[model samples]
Target: MEHEKRDHALLSASGANRWLACPPSAKLEEQFPDTTSDAAREGTLAHELAELKVRNYFYTTDFGKRKLNAAVKKLQKEDLWQDEMMGYTDQYLDYIRVVAMADRIQGTAEIEKRVDFGRWAPGGFGTADCLLLKGNQLHVIDFKYGKGVPVSAEENPQMMLYALGARDMYGILYHFDEFHLHIIQPRIDNVSEWTCTEEELLEFGSYVKERSALAIDGAGEFCPGESQCRFCRAKAVCRARAEENVRLAFSQDKGKLPPLISSEDAGRYLSLGEDVKKWLEDLKEWALGECLAGRPVLGWKAVEGRGSRDWIDMDAAFGKLAKSGLAEEAVLWEKKPLTLAQVEKLLGKKDFQDAVGEFVVKNPGKPALVKESDKSEAITNKVTAAEAFAEGGES
Candidate 1:
């Protein structure tokens, strides 16, 4: 079973999750094993509960406290109700209550379709959370319960993918004019709507077919951006993460801890290392210029001298007060001392010791990267900002 499972090309949005962060995320495939954290499990549980609530609303003839109780029971049967189950029960009840209330007026309870996406991947597969069938139209809804950034359903790639799947599955069953993508987040007071057009769906379907092929060929490593990296599974092993760290180190001017390359970066670096190294040098040069001028780039700081404090010579200042019978502690005042490199070194325990044992601290460049404003005569041929920016374009 394990062998068969391994042989099957089961594509997941997980790799896409990483690729969205950095193109070279695939390099970490072997190095970084996937693990499900609490947040992921919670999301899964919440989604299951939401699905149950929707299912009960659509299928059940009864719509009252009895239905709410039934929904709660259904969630428990699915093993989704655990620790803080009442909160989810309340949530399910509230949603049903809202739908019930809406039904009295216009735009009430409607179940368009459930689990209705047609063909998704290499295999004919798609997901349908719940669809609302209401007055001459269909409304598609997907539940998002994670702490991740809210995705707008209109231009959202995931929703479009789902929509494409829906078009393949449900268009024939029900002739629809307008499509609505409703994103519901119970944890957050989020109820977002996105209207999609037929033309848009067609275009998105074509995109999915084209992109799906890349996944089939195992080429899902195209990097997206920094914000996306926070949720990536391959963050530790992603070459983009390494490159980002390198870029950040150079950009900040404080030297970063030695180059920590992930396995993915190491693989790609075997061929493209030289080019990346040159880019790093150029980036560092540019960073140095900016740092010297005290410009903030990347999340790094300029080497502040050291933090220190000074105590006033109380006897001198408090002589009159002491003679009049005031205590020394009463007149003693502490003052902040000026920061300097020497005091900074003294701040650390090992740094405070003379050359001896493990306690001895060596001059390890800088804790972070440092950009010197003024260069010594020995430091010649520094790459300037204009040179660094123009180097690639000139070619």
Candidate 2:
């Protein structure tokens, strides 16, 4: 999959979720440069690792074996390896196997399978994380490494695109009548699934094909919304989005009656709290960018925040301090690495943790509500069986 050049498609299935909503997004995005992030690299590595595992165990194919091995070696050398990532991949493999067994199929798994939707989507093609066929049912599984937001499959265009593409690629031979789409987002503990018949699938395709064609020609309509704009590259300078957000502020600022806000007004403002916060953050980023380039922003100045002191040459400074008849301990705070409780009055947080970080004590976090599916093992745990049994017996 890495061998394929990402030809900056006018429409791609991965961005289908965004382009379908804001049809002009793909066209506008072409104006900005595509930058890779650490998060994206980690996601790619995770996908590679998961694919390697699945193919090694289930299907025995040497497709991209040499390239895959090299990529796997490169990823294994990275510091991004985490237990949960491996666990998530395992869960994905397990789910596929379970489904395959249930449907009386074996060795139907296809890893990193590229599918082309042909005329159903213009210049549309994407690699499904995993694709398999079981009788008349066609199951498409996608793995998402993001923990930010849970992606749903209800009317999901990306999954729909993959389904259509897979249909185009393998439909001739298998003649799939049923479709089951699944999204496994392990980082957020979100496992979402949706099923649709072949008839309903084609009905949704008509809308995608038209939208995709318009998007490819840069003739798509500009529709702005929170979901559509979240991952958009042009969002920072998009006039439509700026205007939409400005309307909200305009609605809030008109005709102020009293010093104290009414309950209704307060509730409305509270409802828009997230939007306001994001706007402020974007404003700060813009102001900083302008300030750094020596273009001063009105009513805002750039100033350095509080900074810690550091010696120009720590070893030389220590030697110089000792030569000046001052003890080394006086100039530099030196102590054996140990906990405060274990060795009290040793050093301050600035002195010790700054120098010997291993001795530092990490703070325990506050309690917060979290989903049962949360794998953090944080917040709090429910009552254990033993505790429940003891309480029940006591009562």
The RMSD of every model to the true structure, in order and in angstroms, is: 20.2, 8.1
Q: Candidate 2: global Cα-lDDT?
A: 0.76
lDDT, candidates in the order shown: 0.52, 0.76
- Deviation (Å) of 332 in candidate 1: 36
Whole-model lDDT, model 1: 0.52
TM-score of each: 0.49, 0.74
Compose the digit string of candidate 2's lDDT tens values, residues 208-245: 88887778777767887667777778777677777777
Please identify model 2 stretches exceeding 4 Å from their true place. Answer: 3-5, 61-71, 79-84, 252-268, 290-308, 311-395
**lDDT (Cα, tens digit) per residue for candidate 1, span 1-395:** 01112221133332333332333443445444455667766666666556555656555665455765775576566433454544543464465455445534344343323232225446423344554544435566666676455555656655555556555555666655666776766555555678877776676666655656665555666553444555555544345556755654455435665577786655544434433454455455546656779886686555756889864874665886777787766545556674443553444323334333344345644333222321212333689889897885765
Superposition error at 47 for model 2 (Å):
1.3
Clashes of 1: 11
Q: Number of backbone collisions per candidate, in order? A: 11, 0
